[model samples]
Target: MALASLIMLVPVVLVTSFLSGIFGMAGGLLLLWFLFLVAPASTAIAVHGIIQMVSNGSRAWLSRRYLDLKILAIVSLGLLLAMGCLFAVQYSPNKAIALMVIGLLPLLLWIPASWLTFDASRPSHAFACGLISGALTVMVGSAGPLIDLFFIRTKLDRRVVIATKATIQVVAHFTKVVFYINAALMLDAMGWTTVALCIPAAFLGAWLGKFVLDRMSDLQFRSWTRMIVTCIGFAYFVQGTSAVLSA
Candidate 1:
């Protein structure tokens, strides 16, 4: 990457990390879009995974008191299973397909409460959530909306929701980095340095977001999260569709 492009990405990293720190959803989606503009599909996914792992890791640590270990363990088991399955198939997504999948993911947030009764508090549902969302993360580069489907209806407060989701995302993103390591290796020394610089920016953004998160009510958090994700999803879908048609 050019020096100019790398410089431009610093603020993008900070802002997206802040958003993810708050909602634990849209930031990664937005960051992935930005990355895709500058890198190949696989490389963008790998980079996004590395940055998000840091952002979510910081958020998870900040809210460690609210972490739910049991659910995380069960979900991780399902996630690992999904990863194994994908590895067996050696699945990889092209740019257009990846964009379309990510664009469509936000639709999950719009599903009516009565249509699908998924509660992440339940072991079975949580496992399913992990399996499905983990696969989506690896394949499409982001899965915030899909993960939200399992948690939105649960009785857990915003704190628990954010913390637990962040923790799970840390694991998911780490797996993504491992899966796409080869793509990331395409970057040269400067590219690697650029990525390293984004880490502290991500941590700073998450910390700042935590400050705001403490002041927001649960209702506001949930409502705003849905709205932001829906808007971003619509934009991505349009762009993806255009790309596919043009191709």
Candidate 2:
């Protein structure tokens, strides 16, 4: 990456991390879109994974008291199972497919409550959330909307929702980085350095976001999260569709 591009991205990292810190969803979607502009699909996913892992890790640490360990464990098992299945298939994604998948994910949030029955507090539902979200994360580089579907209908408060999701995302993004480690290794030194600089930016953004989160009501949080992610997803879908048609 050029120094100018790297320099420009630091603030993008900070802002996206801040958004994720607040909503625990939209930031990764936006960050991955920016990365896709700069790197190939595999490399972009790897780097996005690294940045998001740090961002969510910090958020999880900040909200550690609210995390549900049992849910995490069950969801992780499902994530592992999904990873194994993908590895067996030797699956990989091209840029258009990834963007289109990401574009379509936000619609998961739009599913009416009457039509949806998922509750992350249930072990069965949590496992399915992990399995589906994990596969989407690996293939498309973001699964915030899919994961949100399971939790949004639950009775858990906003704090628990954010903290628990952050914890799971830390694991999910780490898995993504490992899955694309070869692509990560292909980056030159400057590219690696650019990634390194984004780490602190991500942390700072997450840290700053917690303050705003504390002030927001539960209704405000959920409402804003859905609105923001939907808008971002629509833009990505259009861009992806245009690219596909041009090809």
Candidate 3:
């Protein structure tokens, strides 16, 4: 890695870790932007996904006490199935996808559109969600929110929900990397450079964010959740569609 890039890793790790705690998927967005500055688009997504796995794994591991096993199982199966179809779930995620979502984010923020919830009671259905999440995850750095939307209505403890999502993300990210490997995109020098820089930032950020969120009221948590996802929608809409169009 270049010296400048190596220096960047420290902040990357801290920032990612911090964001993931409050927003399960926020770190991915931050990491994507950082990596986008340093690498190609596909590489940015793959590397950021890996960064999120590590950042979130730390939080989930520390908070294993709060994990909701049933919920995790349901969502995990769906993520796994989605992973199974990684190559087949392709769509041209160009600037158009990014712009469309960015445009919709304002409306989503105003009315808070309903989440397409998943049926946790049915393993088959859960697996279907997982399958789709996994596949899209390859193109999209994070899909845990889609899975979480499915579970959010269940009224589980907030900690348990967060833990389960983090755990499932770890598994799904790991599986997705295998696809990157098969597609020959694993651990390039720049990728490792990003990892080295991002891991510490992510580690610190995620840990601290979790502690802060733990003390927050449910209303605050819900508000922050919407805020973070809104940011992501704008980010994706700008990124995917713009890049594709520009390409």
Provide the overall lDDT of each model, using Cα atoms, as 2-decimal numbers.
Answer: 0.89, 0.91, 0.64
Total clashes for model 3 = 36
Stretches > 4 Å off in candidate 3: 1-6, 88-125, 182-194
- Top-lDDT structure, candidate number: 2
* lDDT tens digits, residue span 5-84, model 1: 88877799999999988888788888999988788888999999999999999999999999999889988988888888
Cα RMSDs of all predictions?
0.9, 0.9, 3.6
Q: Which ten residues in a row have the lowest lDDT in candidate 2?
A: 1-10
TM-score of 3: 0.79
Residue 60 in candidate 3, Cα distance off native in Å: 0.8
Q: What tens-digit string does per-residue lDDT give for candidate 3 at 122-236?
A: 5665677677666666655556555555455556667776787788788777766655653225456765665666666667788898888789876676677767767766766
Q: Write the per-residue lDDT of candidate 2 for residues 78-139, one digit (tens) a residue.
A: 88888788888998978997898899888888899998779999999999999998998888
**TM-score of candidate 1 relative to the true fold:** 0.98
Model 3 Cα shift for residue 37 (angstroms): 3.5
Which regions in candidate 2 have their CA more than 4 angstroms from the true location?
none
- Better structure of 1 and 3 per TM-score: 1
Off by over 4 Å in 1: none
CA lDDT, candidate 1, residue 117? 76
Report the CA-based lDDT of candidate 1 relative to the real structure: 0.89
